[model samples]
Target: MTQPLQIGLVVFPEMTQLDATGPLQVFAGIPFFAPDPGAEVHLLWKDLEPVSTDAIMTITPTKTFAQSPPLDVICVPGGPGVDALLGDSEVIDFVRSQGSGARWVTSVCTGALVLGAAGLLDGYRAATHWAAMGMLDAFGAVPTDERVVIDGNRVTGGGVTAGVDFALTLVAELVDRATAEAIQLRIEYNPAPPFAAGSPATAPAEVVEDYRERTAAYQARRIAAVARAAAARPTP
Candidate 1:
């Protein structure tokens, strides 16, 4: 029997649950991928304690960073915790270390910030929450506005809802297009947003401006976090 693909998902305090759970649900829904009919998905956190999201959702992590199994893929999901994670040496080290062993490294939403902070996004094409894209260039990454962007071994998705598309894309890349299509069909992955405000170009000018204004503080915090992380790194 083929060994199940072991996926490690890193969860942090204040993370957006959908960013992690969306991809997780997609992968876990694939029954034929493993001998036991269930693929292995491990939620790794700094602590094994329950992690809460900004939305007040919480989940228990399966493993701590030190105890995580070897991973075929490492997925980092983003939320307010990304500000904290960007400056966390232990978390960044864990990401950098495990990412080297994994066949693929991916992020959803501002989780790409963590990858950027780890220096993994350097010279790579990446996407993130539109509010956070400007900072990717600070880490030497080329920012794209697409919902999903793949560059070599790195895959990134834009914003919260993009996780599903990112995971489906990854499914096609790792297994086969047939498998991905089957899963998409099973999940009824077709999307039709009720409103056109999903993208900056489609949103009213005032709404787009308001979003940028509201996120200004968070962006400032992220910038400081990234600068601190970059400065603290020992000369390679």
Candidate 2:
């Protein structure tokens, strides 16, 4: 790759900022990690406005979809806002258009659903947030249970935090493992959570049940949204 790497990350309302920023942090360190043939990561949206997140803060898009340069990678991040993205043709069309030409198509967490909605993951093994795992089948995707999955040029991360791992893996693909590891070391990407309850399998039964109960309505809405997006997607 003689040219500079151009990576585009999609941002929207109510998205989990970490899903994009986590991987972004890793990708942004490419210059320091391996100075030659540097990278340019663009935060993209339909317009150049500040997008809100699931948290209190908001993120501003660096480029509009129409204004973005050709991207080597197109990555989407996930959160509560993903439900609306399922039914959004503007975002879906943008992904479909850009992904068709990008060297890599990827997502973090439920952002996989957006790629699916764009018909980008058909017949590919992918990963998404645990809660949205079952939705992959609707898009003709094989849902793999892993923190990160790479099937051909399509890379996906399990959830929000997995974005860091996802990008590090992509960096290895773009450059080398040594560079990726150096970036990892630079970031000190160590995981030693205080609790072992991140996943449903490890969480207490009551805690899991309570979460399921709380999210039942949201999941129901998501299912319906997925159905619509799947139906609206063009067949390949």
Candidate 3:
């Protein structure tokens, strides 16, 4: 029997649920898409317990970080929790250790900031939420505005909803483009938004200013968190 490819998705309090679930639904379809598939995905946290999202939703992790076996892929999802995680030693250590050996290290939205916090993104071109893209430079990453950015084994998605795009891209890399397309069709992944304001460039100026003001506090915290993490990194 072919051993399965173990994939771990990190979960923490205040995370954006879609960031975790969107990619999960895509990867979960691998068995149906690939011939003789070999992949298993799990939600990982500090412990096997319920974690809250940015919204009212809460999800239970399938495995604890300490108990997880070596993963072939490790993904981190972002949200308000990212500010806290950027300064969390335990979570950063877990990400650092897993990423060192995983076949792929990925993130959705500001989750790239978490990877950056772990010192995994140095010299890498990564994607993250447009609102926070500028913050990547603090962690030594060159930020890209694309919906999905891939540099070697590191893949990162733009904002919350881009998780789907990130996952499909990863599927193509792991198996074949055909299988990935099949999965995309299976999920009816075509997106047609009613509004054309998904990004800062497309959104109305007033709306962009409002969002930036609303996120100012979180951005401030994130700035401090990234500084702390970067300062703590060991000297080469």
Candidate 4:
């Protein structure tokens, strides 16, 4: 039997749990995941520390970044913590190293910013939360206005909820279409949001404007953090 594909889901304080957990759950349901052991998922962080999610949830890392197994896939999930992590040299260095070695590198929502900070997004077509799309250019990535964008081995998802779709798509890419479809069916992956405000273009102008305004301060902080990270990196 083929060895299980080792997958790493990176977590940090204040990260959105759904970004990692949703995908992790989907990948765990594949029959081959246990029988043939298609994939084995591990939660990794800078240390084996307990990380909090937006202050509402806490999770413990299964492994430290330095000790994480060589990964077939590495996923980064995002949330408010991204603002702080963007300037963390240890996190950036860990991400840069693992991303370079992994077979596929994936991100959900603002997690793309982490990849950008690690210098992994350069010259790639990537997507992030619509509210943060403009910031992608700052990191030299082409900002794609799509739910999901796959550029070579790097796959990125837009907004928070797009994580499910991203994981389904990744299942097809990494495993097989049959396995992905089965997992989707098992999970009843069809989505129906009660409101149509999920996208900026679909929401009322006032609502969209308000959302952007609310997140403005956070965005400013993230930009400054990314700038500092960029400045501190050794010249290549």
Best by TM-score: 2
TM-score of each: 0.94, 0.98, 0.97, 0.94
* Residue-wise C-alpha lDDT for candidate 3, range 1-236, written one tens digit per residue: 56777889999999999999999999998887674666888899998779999889899999999989999999999999887887788998999999999999999999998898888899999999998899899888999999999999999999999999999999999888998899999999999999989999999999999999998897888888878877875442
Angstrom error at residue 37, model 1: 9.3
Return the lDDT, model 2, position 181.
96
- Ordered from best to worst lDDT, the candidate numbers read 2, 3, 1, 4
Let me know the TM-score candidate 1 reaches against the reference structure.
0.94
Whole-model lDDT per candidate: 0.87, 0.93, 0.91, 0.86
**Residue pair clashes in candidate 3:** none
In candidate 1, stretches whose alpha carbon ends up further than 4 angstroms from where it belongs are: 32-38, 233-236
Q: Which segments of candidate 2 are over 4 A away from where they belong?
A: none
Model 2: how far is 24 from its true place, Å?
A: 0.7
lDDT, candidate 4, 1-236, per-residue tens: 87888889999999988888888888787555445657778899878879999758799999998889888888899998898888788888888888989999889998998888888888899999887788887677899999999999999998888888999899888878878888888889888889998887899999988977997898788778767766654433
Q: What is the lDDT of residue 177 in candidate 3?
A: 96
Q: Return the lDDT, model 4, position 169.
A: 93
